[model samples]
Target: MGLLDLFIASTIPVLKVLLITALGTFLALDRVDILREDARKHVNNVVFYVFNPALVASKLAETVTYESIVKLWFMPLNILITFIIGSILGWILVQFTRPPPHIRGLIVGCCAAGNLGNMFLIMIPAVCKEKGSPFGAPDVCQSYGLAYVSFSMAIGAIYLWSYVYNIVRASAAGTTIESTRLITGQSSRESSTAELGSCTEPLLPSKEPLASEHRIDQYALPRTKQIEMEDSGNKQLLSKLLGNINWKTVFAPSTTGAIVGFMIGLIPYIRKILIGGDAPLHVIQDTASLLGDGAIPTLTLILGGNLLKGLEGSGMQKSIIVGIMVARYIALPIIGIFIVKVRLGFIPADPLYQFVLLLQFAVPPAMNMGVITQLFGAGETECSVIMLWAYALASISLTLWSTLFMFLI
Candidate 1:
């Protein structure tokens, strides 16, 4: 397709995001104030616990199958690559920007996690319906497209909770620890003074030999005692590692929904009951899907409300915003093209699949980051500011990348 054609194809999807987001921004204004902090929180809770899961489960149960899974095995790995590469880029941005400690994770996350879920689901079908779509007939394109989006959404949620969840959580913990230290007056000056005092009082003349003898005594323990001590240490290490994992996050409601949806999709009897038009329990799927339909608009509204915070002033550095924009928009898209063209030989040569793959890299950061930030109560304002700019600029960035991606594909 020509550049003009590609640009036309790309603009529609970007406009969809823009319009909904603009509506959300409007509702959050002082006069409207429909999506105030408390209102947004309640809506976000619904999206997180209920609507998002229902959307994932209902969509996956409808479209995914054993054959589709095998055919699309490369996708999960592609997304993993996106996350890994984007994270490396995010780290680079963090190093240079040096944002506040609380917002470091937010910056990294906004760079790494694209709006994989809703964007994929929305963009693919919309593109297919267009008259100049490079993908096949609308029905066939949409059928396969929805399946691809469903799998992407499900896996993206898994990675979001598994990887991104911990980053934000750690940022929250680090902020809390620093706050506690400040409250308790544990300044660096005190630590330096203590170290200076210890250094000045030289007591090592006889102590060195005694310390060596003590180390020798520890090594001289009976073989059985040494073995027991090693085993105990190993057990303690294992326990510490296991305890570090947030099981609640690992099995987030959205993740659980994806799991159940996969089971229903892969198993024959369950599929028969839950999927298809004539199925006995198809009503359940329909109901869940109807609720799921609300997720996109509600999420966009929440995002808009959050973005309004940026207008009021978020105290985020301008350099950090520019760094994130560069990482996510300018850098990641180039990397994606290189990966898909040069590195990914195993991916099927399907245009629709290739288009979606390329789009994943070009899209803006996930809106869910805001939700996750809210859940953690750290970096909310800074995150909102970052998101506001990232998404505002997405129209131009996504359009340009989409045009290029379509031409390359």
Candidate 2:
């Protein structure tokens, strides 16, 4: 397809999201009050706990088979690479910009987690159905595209919860400690306490260092007993690490649904029960799919509501916003193209697959991060501000990169 045709084709889906998001903004206005604070919170709850999980589970169960997963093995690796590179960039931005401790996580998260789910789920099928689409046979293209999107959503959710969750949580904790110090009028000790309370250090056995006398006494123990003590210490360390992990955060409702969906899709008996027209439990899939269908619009509305804060932001820097735009929109897509081209031997030659992979690099940050920040009660305004600029820029960035991706792939 020609570049202009591709750009037009790519932009249609984004425009749809923008329209819905605009409605959200309008509803959130004081005059309308339809999507006011209480309403937005309730809607966010449904999306996070119910709608997202249903969407992920239904789509994944319908599309992902063992064979398909095997063929698509490189996708998970590609997503991991995005997070790794984005994180490195985020760290660099943090060091250079010197943002407050609480907002550092928001910056890293914006870089690391792209809006991999809703945007792709919307854009891919729309692109597939377009007359000028480069991917062949609309029906086949959509089926494969949905499968790619499902995988992207599931895997991205897993990484976001396990990795980015902790980053934001730590930031939240630090913010709380600093706030407590300020409230209690501990002006002089606040800096030292904030440093002490920072979550940068791993949860360790003790913060206190062993005295030289204690070290000398430990060396006086029998060699055999010392070895045994060291082994026991290692075991305890492993156990402590395991215990410290917040399993509830890691296995969010969406992640749990993904696991269930993978089980249903991969196992023959389960797939027979839940999938296909003839399945006895097909009604369940239909119901879930119906609910899942709500995810994109609801999410976009929340995105709009969140963007309302961007207009009256919490005094975020223009530099940080510019850095995120450059990293996510400019640098990441170049890296994605390079990786896909270099690894062509392993990556499927399907144009849709290649396009989705490249598009993954170009989309905005996940809207779910707003919900996460809300849940933690920290950085909500800052997160909103960052998302507003990133998504605003996404309209142009996604279109331009989509055109380039279509031509390259």
Candidate 3:
């Protein structure tokens, strides 16, 4: 394919996303009020709990088999490398920017998590359909491309919920702790000041003398006993912390769906019964796919609604936005090209597969990061702002990278 054909192929998908996103933005307007904060929250819940799970499960069950899994073993590793390297870059971005604790997760997440599933789902098929495509016949290319995209989606969901989810959660928790400490410290200082002001004798000392160092030491527990007590307390603290976490959120619906899908896909009996046209239980897969179809559009709309906050002034730093853009677009894609080229020996020789691998590194941050931030009610506005910028720049970046990736493969 010509470079212009590749660029056009890439641009179409981004334009589709932007158009839906624009509609979402319109619906969120005060005049429209269709996707206000409360409405967006409710819709976000549906997407998170329902649409997303259905999509992941159905896609995985339909496309992923044990054989395909074995063939694509290196993909999961490639995706993981993207996350790890992006995360390292994100951490470095955080150190340089020193954003608030709450926004730290959003930043790192934006850097680490690429829109692995959705972007590929849109881009690959579009590329395949192009007249001058390099991935062989359109029908064959799309079939393989979609399967690759589905597997990518399933694996990406697992990582997003497990890794990026926790990063945002921990960052939000840290912010809360910092705020509480600041409040407590301020209150303590206020009480101290008040007490000092009310005191009549400014220079008076206590009648009792302070304890001698030897006396204090004598009252202390034995060293071994103290160590044992400290260990016990630490264990209790760890237990309490563990007990406090919402495991449901950790093993999120999307992750659970991926697991279930894997089980169904890998089990021949289950797959035969539930997945093909001739299956007795094919209705179930069809229904799941029907519901799954809503996931992408709904997610895009919600993303648009959330991004309305950026216009209302999210107070996000320009540098942080630029850093993320640079990391995701410039740094990550370059790193991805190098990694894929180095590991070319282990990967499938299929150019489409190689293209998908490289593309994973080039896509924008996951849209679900906005859903995550909204779920936690931490840095929602800031997330919106970052997503706004990241996706806005995605058009040009994806086009250039897609052209380059195609040329390379």
TM-score of each: 0.90, 0.89, 0.88
Ranking, TM-score, top scorer first: 1, 2, 3
lDDT (0 to 1) per candidate? 0.87, 0.89, 0.89
What candidate 1 gets wrong by more than 4 Å, as runs, is: 186-232
RMSD of each: 4.1, 6.5, 4.2
Clashing pairs in 3: none
Q: What is the C-alpha lDDT profile of model 1 across 1-409, one tens digit per residue? A: 5677778888898889889988988999999988889899888999999999999998999888999999889889888988998899889988887778888888888888989998777788888887787787999999999999999999999999888988889888999998888886766778878888889566557444565556544666598678887999999999999998888899998899999899999999999998879999989989999999999888987998999998787777788888889888888888888878875468889888888888888889999999999998898898888888988999899988988888888
Predicted candidate 2 versus true structure: per-residue lDDT over 1-409, tens digit per residue: 6788998998998888888888888888898888887788889899989999999999999999988999889999999999999999999999999998888998999899998899998899889898799999999999888999999999998888888988899888888888887887766677768878886867685667757536554656598678888999999999999987888889988899899889989999999998989999999999999999999899899889988998788888889999999999999999988998788499988888888888878889888889888888788888889888888888899988988889888
Summing lDDT over every window of 10 consecutive residues in candidate 2, give the lowest-scoring window: 212-221
- In candidate 2, stretches whose alpha carbon ends up further than 4 angstroms from where it belongs are 181-236
On the 0 to 100 scale, the lDDT of residue 52 in model 1 is 93
Alpha carbon lDDT at 177, candidate 1 = 93
Report the alpha-carbon TM-score of model 3 versus the true structure: 0.88
The number of residue pairs in model 1 that clash at the backbone is 0
With candidate 1 superimposed using the best TM-score fit, by how many Å does residue 380's alpha carbon deviate from the native?
0.9
